[model samples]
Target chain A: MSRIPNAFAKGTAFIGFVTGGDPSPAQSEAYILSMIKAGADLIEIGIPFSDPIAEGPVIQEANLRALAAGTTVDTLFALVRSLRRTTDVPLVFLSYLNPVLHYGYERFFATCQEAGIDGIIIPDLPFDEKDELQAIAAAHDVDLISLIAPTSANRIANIARDATGFIYLVSSLGVTGVRSEITTDLESIVRVIRSATDVPVAVGFGIHSPEQAHAVAKLADGVIVGSAIVKQIAADPAGASNKLYEYVREMKAALGA
Target chain B: MMADKKRGRFGDFGGQYIPETLMNELLDLEVSYNHYRQDAAFNAELKELLDNYAGRPSLLYYAARMTADLGGAKVYLKREDLNHTGSHKINNVLGQTLLAKKRGKTRVIAETGAGQHGVAAATAAALLGMECEVFMGKEDTERQVLNVYRMELLGARVNAVTSGTQTLKDAVNEAMREWVSRVDDTHYVLGSVMGPHPFPTMVRDFQAVISAEAREQLLEREGTLPAAVIACVGGGSNAIGMFYNFIGDKNVRLVGCEAAGRGINTSQHAATIAKGELGVFHGMKSYFCQDEYGQIAPVYSLSAGLDYPGIGPEHAYLHQTGRAEYYPVTDDEAVAGFEYLAQTEGIIAAIESAHAIAYAQKLVPTLSAKQCVVICLSGRGDKDVAAIARYRGRNVHE
Candidate 1:
């Protein structure tokens, strides 16, 4: 059989987080393309929740802006529904656990499958208490991504064991926010995660600049950029489309992908 | 003697009413419960934990002087009050806490009304080294400050909900909503035989050991089944457990007394069985104190444990099905019963359980002179001793 598409199978991946309806749907398409052009292998689109326990202020503001723009579960569905029309870049939707639970697990997965969402990352929900959801994810074939926190090497080993699609490693101890640098133990996290499985290990939460992404690129299978992109879009929600795209592309170039 | 077999029903009381998100999870729990509930090893493990960890096989105390003072019927107390944490709540908590760990969950969350369940849940969580959060109404936090402090000392976070009515119903809604979101890594330890489907059935099953052991102890002591068994009803766990083993006896009468703070006719009451109408809240369909429009209305009882507006759905079904007769005992009667018990039996009971004592107090005179009665002393009077002392204008410190 022919191999999977080169963009997806590419060794070093670029993951982009664009708040759906940020700037506008038209701008969202533009930002997505710029990231695609700059070697984004997977696109992590966020559908925000009101009580986001795991997110800090940047993404929270982006979610508020998106909510203010009438973006919703339906709107996110519609975005995925529309994106399926043009792109095949693997789509990983970052959402708080409540919206997904409120939407009902099976229906959400069915909707994801219908809208072509490739994976899910719910930061607050850990792995062991996932028996019910695990069945739903398996049934719909929508990957339920896992996060290994900074503290638990043994739990990281276990979470890495239960993970499917790709392992989403949270870069710090706290909620998602901008940080000064990736920690000194960053390489060991990658090594520990890699030891648990051969699945691609993507590091997310704080990488904002090309230099930071490049620094992490030396150690991770992929780098995820969220708060900065959301911050840029929030700064100019109306004129944010092209600027957001350029920012994503510049970060990608600095990572040398 | 499992009242809720097949559909997890206690008579026609329990069944599932969950969103589709939980269908698969509930199904798995049902399968495991059905399988493990009968497995010898499962039963043995649960029994060992109940004995060693929960300090079970509580005692059957002969209320000799109280029996002589009543001067008619013989009364034996099934002392659930003497258990660890000073109540029967530990029995259910230890059971569910262990089960949560077995299911690979790292944390537990629970909602509390009187705070008995919250403290019990916190105790189990601390013992098991699991993360625990107890959701109490902001109003309840103020009312039940001692229990709140007790829960905090157990290393559990006590979340105060200010939304909705700021009571048991509101706390439950918040807890269920939290469980819906965090089901991936947490087990919601429901405090009573309330909520939808499995929980009413699940919690009842855990607490049933109370009545099961009581039945055997009663058989050995009284040489026959008690003429009646009574327990107070809040969300109905203690009552259900006390009556569960007696359900099949056919000759044994089962009674549940709800708190009527003043009278059922007055607004100041938690008499769900007497004054409630058909309504739904916190997952289960049940009898709730509601307006003509069926909107949930505020309910009051001096006892924090009986302040909830709705009775457990299984209790409702048992009432409707005529398996158990329900009554509402007023505050004056309950306080009188509490004082009578402490003076005569030398045992204090939680104010909530005093409702049952008051019911039994009324029943003893009316029963045939030789008849036997076992009133479930569901919890100790220690928690309510301060309030009782205050009610009588006596210095509790003295």
Candidate 2:
């Protein structure tokens, strides 16, 4: 079945996200392996899109860099295949719907299965629009991860109930970026999600520091970091492995795992 | 209009493909819009504003000189250029701003391309006493500098977006980001019929006044329906408005002219229908000019208004069902139409609208003189004088 469940079977999961083929496909594979080696429970590889509407400037720049380096869907799938050869860490893809749609739903998920991808996180495909790919994703044993945002007040229970893989709880309002402080009441949101389903809830968006990761891990089953880690890669694409390993290790440790 | 096969869907297109952070707000906006659209007082207030402030019942003037010059179909120009904000944008802006006010939203934000929609949104916000901010592409700000000053003078903060392509699509991306940050007290006054549902539907209903008036006016003047109705399609608000009332008329052809910057064969055109694939983007499933990987391609057009990568989802649905026909008009042809209309009718239409005029030059000649075609002059050309001069090798600067 899906490797996603085993990720949260332990204590709080530590999810590290990096844009696939950022800088280059080889460099991205190195960085992902680094995170996995540093005790990342799962890895989220962003299939770089031309216009990543859900991202802030940091990830947007990374996507552009990845695309500039000739990153494509096929290349990213190859990267996943390479990653699967080295490690069995549960892997997921964070992408917008367009690239996946362009790849053809059947072919994309089938390839994902072959490449050992566990789940997917599509920022644009909310619960209402999930019907387009939900069944196809399930047939491939791919967990179509659901997201619960700060504004998902009444929708929390409904979305959480039907959610698979895990529930991605957005730590704050707005696009994916680094925030100085996340003031949203996540504990309440997680409580509602917990009452609705047994699926793990991983808080993401704006979680940069270990303290923030530790704080989030208290209320949720996992802590997900993206733009902050992407910033590390953007700073030094070649030398980001050591930095990512340390950061992921620190964040994982902060999760009290 | 054909009924949506599903809620907020037009055939297989137009769904709320957005983040969960914006879902509740969109649902609330839909509820508020649904309520206000039926409320008598809301309609009367919007009507009063459209009539008195924005200038409704825009003239359907017979272009006799051009009609005789062309020696084909009779021509009528829907004078949306004569509106208060000098385009059809004010029609939707006024309606949305009023609805935002009713929803207790004190601030309004919008994305602009040619700055017509930005200026219109600013004017509506000023009239309704709401805070206004407009995001425009950095390139557009340079191209349409005069409209930039116009919006600033009208008390709106204009942000020159420096993101991807630095054009209309980037402006929209920036605006959506701003809205996601603050959806509580603020409302995103989407400028076109492109964005998520309620926007395409609401903007069309607001702009339907164009055809509602033109249909009756045409009947009163010509004693029968025109053979075709034409308008430029950027995000296709004006075209949809012009075609909405006449959609049931099987004989009346609904024509849309898309901007082909250099040519459709080149990579520089913004002809989404002519050279695009189906993809989900900017909060809707629509036809977008994209690469094989579904990455939105950077589109080009002389008219900043039409320099968008995608069309409104409804237009996609319309194109799919063979209900409307869209043709790509090159910038050179549009410029020719721009000059021709100025000289013949003493009316300088917006370059975006000139695309429709350029297409009419080809289409009208194919029809008999007994037939007629009405073109929606979506905006004034005053803002384009400097650009047109520059395009013609003159060193004119605004």
Candidate 3:
């Protein structure tokens, strides 16, 4: 009965992320469509926040650019509404909690429902504080996604049991950025999560390069690539759509391989 | 006397709304704080530092000349300005730095808006033999250069943050970002009673000594409770500290003066409780200066110390429950208060504290001669002299 489609139903899913208005809304919309065409199973749109504490410099700069270009939550919703008309890609909003709180939780979730947002990932909203927005997200059939970090330790099982949609397993111990190596004992964390829940888990954060994506996909249901995709837009916004599409295709192919 | 249901949360505010990566660190911090705060040895060492080093039991001076000049109520000034670093900031930095040492962290990091907290943190770190680094907004470092030099002189490495608005909020953002990676060896000495839990409560407990001393000093001198207790609110550290002991006293009015910048009607103000909407930012669910898009608005004030986008969560709770009254003090009113008190009492108060003095000037006219008022002079104005001179269309060499 839910409009939200499963992103991992076919194969090792490819989840691609882009800030809603990194260069401009139209360009971002074009980029998203291109990524979808290039085999992105799920699309995560970042709603730029003034203070994104969980993000590293790359994403932080992207957020600043998006905000500079006049990106608002309403405009992001409008973008989502437009995307829903042509594609059935599972779309999620990667945002901090303040914007949603300011938008009014009830209205925010209701708008997400109308605009066809499949899930919401607020990195700052830990499991203990999930109740603040969980009921509203559920009432609108929006998945309030949970994150299980390498540092979760005893809290991993607790977070896993209540997770909806897919769990976002953070690959490293720090903020979202590309890393040469992920030293966290992710296999142990994934084991703890698997023992507790039946929901699918997707590994994210510090994942860049198709080889890295291939390696992460081997461990989980899907691989989430964010900063890598966003960094392309940052490098050349004029040629971002084509470049990002190529990058997404490569990552998606690697996931399947 | 309503108790917080969770470890955090003052009413519907305050929580660990941080990234999952910081969860274990915060949990570890909470455990260490809970354990050490109750330990007698920890309390005794902290008490010794407060008394012998930072100059605790700060003077409760009777402002007789100002009281006579105002011609309404007897007035007293809780001289937190007389502390070693010339502000109530030493009260909190000393406590946090000591705790950091106990946690075996060798380095301490902090963010500063006005640079007073930075100076205090640097002072504490130097005394405790810990490495100190302070992140200050580039704009703030420019405005408060003397304090920047003072911090460097005290052996602190100051990083000027050039990100978003280049102000206090940005400084805090950079500090928190740096903390996420280096939390292993560094303890973030958050300057205010804001941020996530334990911080709001921890800072308040450390600052409560102000009101505790003021209450005793006032009772001894005046033989009765003052009609009101007043302090300026940025993130509401000194205000919360000055107000903590008096919360149960139903008749003692607890007043907080917020920076109105140019005016409350203008978009440039930092009067969060006066003009902001309830939302979550900087880890706490409190009133913040934000737009319809939920982007934090650029907040301004002549006093760098008072130029913050949000108040502490406890201030939000107190404002919501009507436990205290908050008023907006315009830039002009605060500057006038600064000059007025300087001329009348020969005391140059920090412009942040001048907001409280300005509020007292208004309230004093309405009270009887027998009534008394007490204001927390949260810091000295030496660091602000150049800024004040610039405001008056004058230039200073030193």
Candidate 4:
């Protein structure tokens, strides 16, 4: 029943991410619709947290902007409900565990199902600690995405085998940001993940530029971009929708989708 | 012994709630720590550093003047202020840096609030010949300027973090980010019993030497255990160390004093246990001062060391089980205690430790003279003289 599988049913999937309620809830909804219109296969909406340790300066600043705009969990759920009326794109949430825990697991996931959210990616909740919310997420028909980094050498196969929706492969060793050059051997890491499961592998973190997306699409099933889109929104909040549409379109075309 | 029922848990608290990039490194650190904790040679080397370099077996001095002034319980002060780095932070820093050396780590990084832990880490790194870097809040660097110079003189790079609520918590966030960037030849020498897994346990074990020595010292001097033991709690390293050996003693009370900047009722306070809720941040599930939306609140305190938003997980477990008692001590009362100790015993204790002294001032008068109490004097107050003078409206330059 999850729409995550359909995202990768085509050739390579183009996943675009933006922090929900960034600038404003209305603007965020408009931006997400823009990406969807520009051929984004799946969309990841970040629920702004107070301290996002996993994020870099770009997304951290965006979280502050969203929070400063008086965005809350209830407002974001309303935003999603509005989006579902027009679009059937596979939507996911990127959040830290605290906000989800504060919202109560049962209520948060049930609301996710009602709002038409297909999956979630929690950067702070590693595979060892996923047992706290794994069952509850599965009971609600939501896929709990798992991440594998370059440091996750032996843990790659074990985590990939049990991952649902898709596997988020970190392109480098640091926090989320744009990098001039990613020198990590992602092809070898993707090979280990491919050997362990049939799930789609999507690379994110430090990914930007069409050339980088095109190169990554060759080895993985999807190419995910976050900070690059967030930077566009930060530069000009009111005009971000058009910029986001063009950026997502360029990245998706580079994926050869 | 309060062994964790789960691998990294203390009751329903304490888990490795971190990114995947750091999980393998934490697991490896746990394995290396477990191996070295029991190895006799490693223990002997650490013992040498603690005894010769850091000055262990700190005295349990009978505070005759303070006892007569209070006119109630007999008082003893555990003199951790006399240690080489002027605080109890040296105890854990020596152990961690030595362990990092044994594990073949070439560099060490840490986060500090009052700059006590930063100085301690730099000293240990210098002694062990490892590269050292410390992250401190930009606000803290202004308040504790001299300590910043101390860390620099000891050969460590001090990074002024300017993130959210630029304080101890932000420093921790920046340190974790830096560690994620380079975990191969680096070791994050966590300063307190607050971080993920091995840190809370390992730091506590290293600091448990406080109560281990004090218990025997009390027995040798008083011929019996004290009625209560008291220490201030920030990230709660010293308090946990002071309370660890006494946890099995049902009759001995374990007390912790928290920093209430203005008062617990006001928004300007760092009293986590008094006003915080349960949430996960900074790699642990514990009581944190946060908003209804789970955003970490900016906490305030006169003492930089205790200006943290969350408490250690073990402290959270201890509070849940009602094994220990915690109280909020306002900055005014702590300043009174600071002056009281300096005038009575001629010992100026750290403001963070003065919180415990403030609570003792209230509790001692209610107890009978036959009973006794011991307070952990966790650090020296030399670094606080300028700040304290400024707070009293005297604006003395450092």
RMSD of each: 9.8, 1.6, 1.9, 1.7
Decreasing DockQ order of the candidates: 2, 4, 3, 1
On a 0 to 100 scale, what is the lDDT of residue B172 in model 2? 96
Tens-digit lDDT track of model 3 for B1-398: 01224768888888878877777778788889999989999999999999999888899999999888788989999999999999999999999999999999999999999899999999999999999999999988887788899999999999999888899999999999888777789999999999987799999999999999999999999899989999999999999999999999989999999999999999889999989988888778899999887888899999888999999999999999999999999999999999988999999999999999999999987888998899999999988787788789898745
lDDT of each: 0.76, 0.93, 0.90, 0.93
Q: What's each prediction's TM-score?
A: 0.61, 0.99, 0.97, 0.99
Instruction: Please give the lDDT score for candidate 3.
Output: 0.90
TM-score of 2: 0.99
lDDT of 2 by residue, A1-257 (tens): 89998889888999988898889999999998999999999999999998888889999999999999999999999998888888988999999999999989999999999989999999999888898999999999999999999999999999999999999999888989999999999989988999999999999999999999888888888989999999999888778999999998888888884
Model 1: CA > 4 A from native: A1-257, B1-6, B9-13, B393-398
DockQ of each: 0.03, 0.65, 0.60, 0.64
Rank ordering of all candidates by lDDT, starting from the highest:
4, 2, 3, 1
TM-score of chain A of each: 0.91, 0.98, 0.97, 0.98
What's the distance in Å from true for residue A92, model 1? 31
Clashing pairs in 3: none
Alpha carbon lDDT at A46, candidate 1: 80
Best by DockQ: 2
- How close to the true structure is residue B265 of candidate 4, measured as C-alpha lDDT? 92
Name the docking class for model 1: incorrect
After superposition, which runs of candidate 3 have C-alpha atoms over 4 Å from their true positions? A1-5, B1-5
